[model samples]
Target: MRGRHCRSGRTGRKRRQKQQSHVDSVSLCHQPQYVRLMRFLHKQGFVSTLLQPALFSDTGRGLQTLKTIKPGQLLISLPESCLLTTATVLSSNLGHYIKSWRPRLSPLLALCVFLVCERHRGEASDWFPYISVLPTSYTCPAYFTDDVMAVLPASVRRRALDQREAVQEIHSSNLDFFRSLQLILSLPVEDVLTYEALRWAWCSVNTRSVFMSHPSNDFLSGQDVYALAPFLDLLNHRPDVQKSFCLQVKASFNNTTRCYDIRSVSGTPHFQQAFINYGSHDNQRLMLEYGFVAQGNPHSVVYVDTDLLCDALKRDRSLDQKIKFLRENDFLNNLTVSSEGPSWRLMTALRLLSLPQTLYHQWKAVLLGQAVSEEREEWSLQTARTLCQCLLQDTCKALDKIFFLLQHCDQLTREQLEVVQALRQEEKCILGSCLEALDGMWGQRDGLLSCQPDVGSVS
Candidate 1:
């Protein structure tokens, strides 16, 4: 879709063409840069058999199939030499000088440093062609102004703040190294290692880097480590798609090539575009790092602060110890609301924190998945119902506040409004699902209580 939609005004209409022109100028006008990048790829033996980069109206840029790719076709492949990874940076001519700073900098941050240094070099840098095509700006929430950020939900704001702090920390801690490299390379520090430059590089890596398990590299210790696959990154992300390629580092002409050996996971059909899974990331994460949000992310979740529950129970001073217990056990935060309802820890906390003193031990056993008597189960369910209803009420109030802001906040920008609306809608969907699950549980509870023997009819 176009980046912005007109809001039905003469001024808005005037702005639309200007904005579209700017987006196209960056996305479409960079054809020569992209073409040169592909040539660089071909020189390095990174070839695509079935797919090619094509611009679309809906999504700015993505891979379009050149031919009908079958179930087991190797659509694309890239040599290991093509990837701009940590190992690649370490092995570069500048690696010898930069290795001394490695003790303080992370592998990822080291790569960012390499990018900034190379960026300042212009055509002098070996990867200048690849660097030229990198995006000039990002749409991530971290780039949002304070006024725009204030309208976002608490969870998103918290995440954005945390990201800002991280970028600041990285910038501050590496300033000396950044300066040293500038002096060593005889370049201006302001133009090279500025926080803004590092941030752009960081986001570029965050959004596009792919995992590779290079057999030769042992410095990276994880299931798989990330590498910036240049041409591979041109393909836009589609979270739900039948992936038809597998990445492996194979021995190539002299150096190893990170080959995308394609074999369709499911039966392949006539699809216009191809995509690879970028991990099961939620919309919040995608927007924070990648500058985009999926319409209906299956991995989406809603977070209610633990403090909300504490506020709900403020009048009941007797639950203070239970709250303390919850904190000690590390169950007092990230109370997630999902399609399946409140997470297990959340439900357990709700039951335990609200249980009566007499039944506390029984409830604790039940929380631990032990058997409990029918009377205890009935009592627990009743307590759970009360707690769930309270949570539901709080969630609705939260939604109402979002609606109120959207209705009354006249100062929101078109971009800000879009972000707010998307986030609010996603949260509402999760909350609505949670409410449905609560109602179903309540119905089951009523049925259980009704089936119990009537003591009034008994002797």
Candidate 2:
């Protein structure tokens, strides 16, 4: 009788558990909050964002908590007091961010290796053991403020830093392990720039190789972090740059020796997009959020010394000292740019050159009967129009990039129909991308769409 009762109890418990499981499934299917949360994840990262609508809908708070749960997706809470915005970009590198970066069974080090392989198109015969170990590196800790430190675990304290360009390495035996692998990688660019060097360090320790963002020479002392001289496109480069020239890596290429061999991912042109120098300040903040951002307690900002380049241009008795300065100060050459421009000589020469991007040009236009000065009452509308014309005519990729520039300078207002309407008329068809531009006043202009529904609405 006792044995029979025990069996009956077991059967009853199993039946109840089955009923509970069925109820849980029904609740998950019907939940609205689950739907919204999944949508948010879908829009955020590379892999986590790729799961079909059904998979993540029931994940609930499982994905949102910040116990360092996700690899590529970082959780951050910034005070409303800060002047900065757009801090979401610092979480991962550009080479393999599939638009989603949630953590997985493997750490970030492992995922980066997987990406390097996935992005590679070369034959399997070309994959080498040494080259395969490039992604497991996590030496540099992502830096944050005091508030940021409190939320992380005790183990994480030794991992990140606060300085923008400072390469804050995590205290791990893996550091030495990474250095060993660097000696094996035959990176085309001999010296890895600061960020790239850390990436190389991580890649080496991963026991798997990954794609290098640029060739070894991409971070030349005098070039833009975005492009090399042979490289034409500057905008496709990631904006979160390590703004130091002090760090670099050493590599050797002996493919001929067949000592260790792998096929190369040749450089591709990325010039179709335009990048701006807004990177200078934001790069620091981005690293801060990413846990890889490094800094000191009492921070100091430093810039590249361009005094010699400016002086060289000024002393040259060539065509126009301004042109020489212009070439030297090209925005793409941040490693050689500075506040000093050989002082007055460079400025005066720049003024005389009639460069379109100059106070000289605005003045010249006024002299040539184009733009009117602030002194004249009639100059206001014409000045705005001229500025708008220049903005419209520039080699722009998307309205968002253009709008970003305009927002930096308050002179251009998105609501100004005179400028926007004129632009819409000339550009022919509206690009599909502009509809969602944050800086554009498209919703207000929906009235235009109502009257002409077929009209394309761009930012």
Candidate 3:
């Protein structure tokens, strides 16, 4: 994403910049592990001569185009042999144990086990080239320390804790299967399959695996849909890519070639980093799954919890009934504020909560987009403004706490602090935007108490 060219600079400066770019590209391309990976991929019938690896100042590792690429050009075609799928695991020595185990392992757990075992095998493993380049440690929330976790917003922190527990439970529940590995492995099974080892393996598979459809396997516990594509995973996500451009390069399994292919929909100049769209994931999801957040992400959002909504709109005894209705209709979840202001779901919930007991019978109409009265409309707007203001204050306080932690806490690494700060900053921006939209709507009505709308009007 950082490969954009500077076209307006002076000719001498441009030439020097180009020279430095060439040097950086060459240095990354010649890295020993990448060199080994390329050779291995070539031997396995994988070829992508159009692209080479490069390190960016922002995004660490990404693929760079070797030449000017044209629209509809095949950027990468990874052969089946190079793909590490469940089929690969089933065929290996580990496959025999998987078949004989009592409780079938989930497709995810199987991949995690394979990665850890293979990594422990060192150079003797066939995937040594690919495995050698993986990050020694990851920054996913599971890897975050308690001090760093304390700085995360309440909702995000809860989800992060759930993720950590899920991984831990997976490891704890599979101890018997791990123990059985003692028969095949040289070292004690406990030494190689510890919780930390499994955590590393799980993060590797979770963050980098590509989706590849596999037929139903009775032996596997979950849906068979994950493949570790060796060189293809090097392509980092670019959240800013236009949807139309992303559509041009279709990625799918090529049945005829038995390879995974990706073609460019638009042309890219030589020496620029080639990126792939990883869907329109927000900064929160990106941080949760991939351990990184995008800057200026269009999909970023600020979540409003059910408790916060209730707290802002607490007015009468009917509050319980309104909350029950909202929950039953599945509107309580996914309540958020974004760059587009409060989501429709949030507005609908607010409208329902603002209804007076005398008009409670018409609650369904409110949800159906009918405005009962100008007073009710004003109430909803006031409640929304109150919620946004509360969240903005909370965000500012969180930022202050983060600054204090950064100054005094030695437990958190620089990368962890930066990630926490970025996530909070993004939430602050979204809340500010929501407040602005609410103010604009209030200004449009001139004076809330005086303005009146026709009863039963549809908004």
Candidate 4:
């Protein structure tokens, strides 16, 4: 009797779990825009019936397979007709005005204009299904408010500000061109193409567009290599998805079918979310560009700038010469600390800086990885320790400020707060790991130094 009761309890739990799963899948798939998108894709002959939109607890909205997918299977094959590219814009109703404009528009700006115009058109637009499903607003740094920006790391904050300025410049420079559209748009061109609207459109293109090579055209000013793949863009990035399943999904233009296709390199279990690699980007790049950060990202790094290095090592008369050498050799930039402690470029720069003015002739040898002396090596290690300790302190303070902001800053949305918090935590983790590695190295060196006799004192 006892055994039978336990069996029934287990069966009841399984049934409830299945019911919850069904609810999660149906919630987003049944949305009006998603329903319309599916219908439109089918009408255009998109034939990946195995994949369907499903919501996951961790990843939010992503595509999932209804059944187990086999290796080398075609996951998605979207017709060229369905893609939104600069070519699509050239052939659009606005194409006539675009072609006649005095200066040609870059492929990117052209896409931004098209997205904004079509979004204004509502259901009247031909690509309404695809446009309707795109995120109405993006969380990219360009959209961050001043208060939110204040919480970002110093390096990331600078880039974030630059991104915002670049978008603003694009809008300011093209205002007259946008005004010219009054001839075609029923609404006031300025009203529809406001800075906010243009920002939204820019973010959409920047974050969601896939790279699809197109032929050079006199009509476009810059690189013609972006395509907006609608349903396929729904796939999110997962860093370890490749390692776990060997799922090498490659997206390419299928010239034979005149469509864009994605195929899996290995089998994926049924009901699992399908992910695509967006290159091996660090959390900083991911957050700055895509408005999200990946936890446990193996590629995550903590950047160390020249100013910070100078501060840690104590500025000396030879600092300018050292800086010049680094710049000339292309080692001044990209100095960073990772899980393995300071990068080689960082250590090399430190070794050169640690040398006395008397031993300056050995600078080239240091760059060549030739060991100069134990004293110089010890100096470089000490300098590295100081820099990492400073970084750890700064990271802790940033985390504290973020926590305070999360509690007090009502101007930021819940999502914005979460992004800021996650970024700071990731930095802290990297710094902590780096400090641990540095400590181990420092301890080993201390023991070795104690065992060796001083060269100056030796008989």
* Superposition TM-score, candidate 3 onto the true structure: 0.89
Candidate 2 structure quality by residue, lDDT tens digits, 239-345: 32223111111112233441111111121121111111223332223233321222221121211223423432333344254445445645212321011211233
Clashes of 4: 0
Q: What's the lDDT of the predicted structure labeled candidate 1?
A: 0.64
| Candidate 3 wrongly placed segments (more than 4 Å) | 1-27, 243-250, 408-412, 449-459
Can you give the lDDT of residue 451 in candidate 3? 38
Stretches of model 4 off by over 4 angstroms after superposition: 1-27, 245-248, 410-412, 446-459
Per-candidate Cα lDDT values, in order, are: 0.64, 0.27, 0.81, 0.81
TM-score (all chains, Cα) for each model: 0.75, 0.18, 0.89, 0.90
Candidate 4 local lDDT, 1-459, one digit each (tens):
999999999999888756633423434678888899988888988866778787777767788877788988998999998898999999998898789887999999999999999999999998899898887777788888887788787768889999999999999999989988987788998789999999998998898888888999878797888899888888888776666432346688999999999888778767767788888898889988888888678888888887786665444656777678778988878888887898888889877777677887887899888767877777677667777778878878877877777787564355776887888788888878888997788787643444322222211
Selected candidate, larger lDDT, 1 vs 3: 3
Q: What is the lDDT of residue 47 in candidate 3?
A: 77
lDDT order, best first, reads: 3, 4, 1, 2
Tens digit per residue, CA lDDT, model 3, 1-459: 233344434666867756644424343768899889989899999877888787866678887778888988898999999999999999998999998888899889988999999999999999899899988878899888887788787668899999899999999999999998988777999899999999999999999989898998778987888999988888888787653122224477898999999888678577777777788898888999999988778888888898787676554556777789889989898888886678787888878877666777887887787767777778777777777788888889888887887887554365777788899898888888888998788888745854323222312
lDDT measured at residue 305 in model 4 versus the true structure, 0 to 100? 85
How close to the true structure is residue 436 of candidate 1, measured as C-alpha lDDT?
Answer: 79
- What is the overall TM-score of model 1 with all chains considered together? 0.75
User: What are the RMSDs of all candidates, in order?
Assistant: 10.0, 25.1, 5.6, 5.6
